[model samples]
Target: MTFPLLLIPGLNCTERAFVPLLGSLWPLASVTLVNHRRGDSMAAIAGAILAEAPPRFALLGFSMGGYIAFEMLRQAPERVERLCCLATMARPDTAEQAENRRRMIALAEQGRFDQVIGANFPNTVHPDNVDSLELRDLHASMARETGAETYVAQQRAILARPDSRPDLAGIRVPTSVVVGEADMVTGVDGAREIAGGVPGAELTVIAGAGHMVPLEQPDAVGEALAKWLRR
Candidate 1:
């Protein structure tokens, strides 16, 4: 059986972030890439996405999108048929993490957005792929396209997002937590935390990948998502 799939991209990431997985997913599902740049708060962003989303659909959220996903589940648990959290965590940002985001926002505001994007590009992929011009350029392109304003807003939203740990146990839908074994941003421990909280949630750790697992190891990440969608 086939169903609608709603995808929420990460901070400063456009639909381009999921392009690699689309080939494997297109035939198995009706996919929609959500627009999450319009709102400054998690609630506002989730509400806007829900207002335009299908009545019910499989939901996949990556990075900051996971925060919005939690908010959506809180607002309308009945609307999500299944959930996939990719390279994300259920906890709110730590003080250090929040500080880093503030620094990035400041850099963006100072018209050094390119530097901010460049610095983050290497962290998105595994060390082996850090020198890959293709991945680096793609990351930069996506960030530039997303623009500084949206980037700042997303950083702020993520910083202010509520801790989703308590709500995980209440999630009734089928759930999958996918993360890169080498993820520097959220790390495997974070993924484990989410999987442990959600009843019967499956955990997929993709080796040789990092924060941007979908792009770093497209085939592996695609297979993981396809399996979850089939389940």
Candidate 2:
């Protein structure tokens, strides 16, 4: 039987975050997009997904979703058949990063999410995509759907996640790390860290892409996933 596949979205992201890749890959596996809006901690978010997931499954997570994926692995390694992380990190939030999340939460509480979105979108896409209407609209719609409360919840969750680097050295499952070469948020360095620690894991960097690598280069991401599945 084909293993179940769980797709986890980033901060303030919904199922639409996987829409681009889903069209091409859904037929190959049972794909479920796990929601991250309800939980205020990584453990809680991972627990929610674990509660709803099948007995054994493959996990594909992007950005903040990747953090939850790591937590899931920590929670139950045997249940994860395969693992993939896109534009994510294994380290806990630095003091500065934690401060930034706190500030974002404060802004959300003050009803300044529009400002938050404006500031965040530029960092989300590559420079070439900064003016792309499709990218802008997609991100705008995602942010709108997520709303301030969800964003705050995700930020808090991310800030509270433990450093996962130590855990990576022990992950025995097939693993892959995908990243955008131009990703500024969680750059190639983060991807390298993950791939380096996970024995025999592959790392793929898509050109001309940024933090939103899955959305920016869906075909490549899909191909990578398909290859991993076939292995």
Candidate 3:
């Protein structure tokens, strides 16, 4: 049976983050782009999405969205027909990572939001795409749409997020884990951890891409997701 697909975008991102892959996925099932920017906590965000979501859906969560997906599963596992996590880890924030987020939040609060987004852009994609003006502009535009206040709230939520690694094996849905080979933010190791933890979960590692796998390698991601959907 086919289930409606629910798409969740990452930090400082909107539905635009998944636009590139919609063409390939639209034919597979009904698609819903979720608004994850309304809440400052994962529970709140996931709860809000669940409240407005279809009774059941195939969930695809990108980067920070993956974290929310885990929370959603905790809150309502029966509603998720399948799961796909893209470029995100099942771990909680490390001390260093939390400190880094705090620093970015401080910068955004000080009216240097653009600077914060600009500095983080390079790490989000492959080295080859670092200088691609088109990708850079798209990233910047999405960040702008997300805005500074929401950025801070997202950072806070990310920092406070729980470790989801423990819950991985408990997931019973058809699951797939996708990541970029060169993803420094959430590398193959993280993907492997999730894939290994989840019974019968498949892992797809796209070469020459980074954390922004959906934007950096949409075709490959679409293909991988299509396979997951078919299963």
- lDDT scores in order: 0.92, 0.87, 0.92
lDDT of 3 by residue, 1-231 (tens): 456999999998899989999988898889999999888899999999999999989999999999999999999999999999999999886788788899999999999999998999999999989999998999999999999999999889999899999999899999999999999887789999999999999999998799999999999999999999999
TM-score of each: 0.98, 0.97, 0.98
Candidate 1, 1-231: lDDT as tens digits: 679999999987899999999999998899999999888899999999999999999999999888899999999999999999999999987888889999999999999999998888878888999999898888888988999989988888888889999999999888999999899998899999999999989999999999999989999989988888887
Q: Evaluate model 3: give its TM-score.
A: 0.98
| Inter-residue clash pairs, candidate 1 | none
lDDT of candidate 2?
0.87
- State the weakest 10-residue window (summed lDDT) of model 3: 91-100
Off by over 4 Å in 2: none
